[model samples]
Target chain A: AQSVTQLDSQVPVFEEAPVELRCNYSSSVSVYLFWYVQYPNQGLQLLLKYLSGSTLVKGINGFEAEFNKSQTSFHLRKPSVHISDTAEYFCAVSVPTGTASKLTFGTGTRLQVTL
Target chain B: EPEVTQTPSHQVTQMGQEVILRCVPISNHLYFYWYRQILGQKVEFLVSFYNNEISEKSEIFDDQFSVERPDGSNFTLKIRSTKLEDSAMYFCASSEAVRSYEQYFGPGTRLTVT
Candidate 1:
């Protein structure tokens, strides 16, 4: 089984400021990591994924995340944020199988960007 | 870009009423899934389907819940008897093939059981 933990429930940042949303996971074996974003009145949009190679994964909207295997963490970051970037972000993990499997999601981090 | 689509953006029903949520996955996709998010809770997986049958499901998918691919383009989730706790945002998703890990999501249908 796989589980994801997002330490912070909410994060507030000023416009053009860098922000980081922390995520950690526990799994018995190798798994894939992902980050998704949801805007108001919309569905989850895939931001990025970490399947193999490259610990540093880049996502849309200038967002990126690093998969630190030793720490069991996949932290999402952005060098600068905009008001439009305010939304809910979720970290997810899934164990790879011969076929597609389920995704275990975190509680989600609400990013509130202010002026 | 091709995307998954769902119908009945919002649905309301009384307790004990049966509700069927529908989805249309991407044209070339071969896998489908259902997930729900109660207010203030994490998104929970309900089930996954492929080749017109359920490939996997979570405990949350109990006897009251069932899935069917009645046709080539439509996938439905039927709740035999909806409880108040069943009120949540249900999302439909799909992936291209067996090895594809990227799953596209739909706008979701908000089920409000009264």
Candidate 2:
């Protein structure tokens, strides 16, 4: 079984300020980590994923996340944020089964990037 | 550039009535999925389908909930009887193939059981 925990329910930051959203997972086996962002009335968009290889992965919109195995964390970070970056971010985990894996998502963190 | 699409952005139904949600996956995708999120809750997986059959389903997918891929492009989810608890945003998604965990999601249909 896999589960994701997002400690922060809401994060507020001013424009051009850096931000980090924390995520942790619990699993008995290796799992794939993913970060998704949802805008108002929009669907979940894949922001980034950690399948294999490098622990630090860069994603769209100048966002990045580092997979810390020892800590069981995959925290998302951005050097600076814009007002447009205000959205709800989710962390998910799943074990790849050679087919579509059922995802377990976190409660989500609402990023309120204000000017 | 293909994307998943869903119909009936918002629906209002009385309790005990049946409601059907529709989805059209990417033309080339081979995997389809259904997920839902209550107003402020985390998104929960309902079921996953492939090759015209269900591959996996969560416990929430009970006897009252059923899924079908009747046509090449259309996938549908039907709830036998609606309850207030069933009100949520239902999202449809599709992925290309095996190991392609990146599923493209639709705008979602807001089912409101009144």
List the candidates' TM-scores in order.
0.99, 0.99
Question: Per-residue lDDT of A1-115 in model 1, one digit per residue for the tens?
Answer: 8899999999999999999999999999999999999999799999999999999999999999999999999999999999999999999998888687899999999999999
- Judge candidate 2 at residue A21 and give its lDDT: 100
| DockQ, cand. 2 | 0.84
DockQ of each: 0.81, 0.84
List the lowest-lDDT window of 10 residues for candidate 1 chain A. Answer: A94-103
lDDT tens digits by residue: candidate 2, A47-109: 999999999999999999999999999999999999999999999998988887888999999
Write model 2 residue lDDT over B22-99, tens digit each, in one string.
Answer: 999999899999999999999999999988899999999999999999989999999988999999999999998855
lDDT values, one for every candidate: 0.94, 0.95
